[model samples]
Target: MNRKEFLAKLGMGAAFALTATCLGSCSSDNAGETGDVDFTLDLDAAANAELLQEGGFVISNKVVVAKNSDGEFVAATVVCSHEDLEQIVFQNNIWRCTAHLAEFNQQGEGLNANGSNGLAIYQTELSGNMLRVFS
Candidate 1:
């Protein structure tokens, strides 16, 4: 190839390589390292029957603790399944996603157009007044 043509091709190749590298580094998945996220909820303070009846349900970016009608305490992640956003809010005994307005029952069942892919329900164990949640 001619000198001018060879130099132009080399420059174009370098530009493509640089663009790919920059794009790879800009991914949201690389924002942080995923680690074990474990949290404890005070069942007495969080999952009382009176509160559930009064507030309907409790949804927060933080872990939610609630007792079913069977008197069993339940805890689960409040993170939204759609976009990993903390959009779940507790009102009227149901969990609702603020982002897409998707609603879920206390059991983490989706109740809207975004059904099927529900909230992430973590395993919970109660020890006295505290409920521990783990993946």
Candidate 2:
């Protein structure tokens, strides 16, 4: 190839390589844990207004807290078991990872190939507008 053509190809290849590297490393590895968790949310608080609606959810303290369609509270780690990425959220009354699309049930059991490791679940209790999530 001509010198100019070769240099152009080399530059394009370098750009592609850099893009790939950045995409891989730019994500946070904040998923997979926070041992011995024990926290509470006041249902009457504006920050937790979602809890008042069935099938709504919020993420706090590295945990994804949700109110199922049945108006019951459930909790799980805000991490995908497959890649340990903090992309877990509640949708359709179950846990889903936006990064890799891993899915888990309320019981923290994997529901798909990408969720093979399952998820870490927490115990929840509700009393007088207070919701407690514990390990």
Candidate 3:
């Protein structure tokens, strides 16, 4: 059938319902929800061995913890402020959302239009081989 005939047979309500379902599935239930986050990681552990290297990062408890180029630990919520997607990654000393490419600085300041809402930042403390990340 032609496009119009096909659409007419499908019905607008059905089309809208399908569209709504697709949109809903693309959203996150944890949107805008950065829960109370206070955790610790052992740098000596193999799971967190990346933190020992400069410019390495890990995602834990929905938080992106990274060791910047300065050999310092920095952290931010993995949830992107733009689309509320858990796709934040640490790269080149910047927090970027892989979903929409939103960028934020180490201090959680938004650096682009998609990231203007800013990200949630946490404090980090390193004592011995333990790294503490807290909101």
Candidate 3: residue 2 Cα off by (Å): 36
Model 3: per-residue Cα lDDT over 1-135, one tens digit each:
999998897897775765565464444333244878899999988999889889999989999999999999999998887777789999988999887677889988879766777888999999999999998
| Every model's TM-score | 0.50, 0.76, 0.76
Candidate lDDT (C-alpha), each: 0.56, 0.83, 0.83
Candidate 3 RMSD to the correct structure: 8.1
Flag clash pairs in model 3: none
Cα error, residue 128 of model 3, in Å, equals: 0.4
Scanning candidate 3 in windows of ten residues, the lowest lDDT window is 24-33
lDDT of 1 at 90: 64
Colliding residue pairs in candidate 2: none
Clashing pairs in 1: 56-93, 57-93, 59-90
Instruction: Please report, as a residue range, the 10-residue window in candidate 2 with the lowest summed lDDT.
Output: 22-31
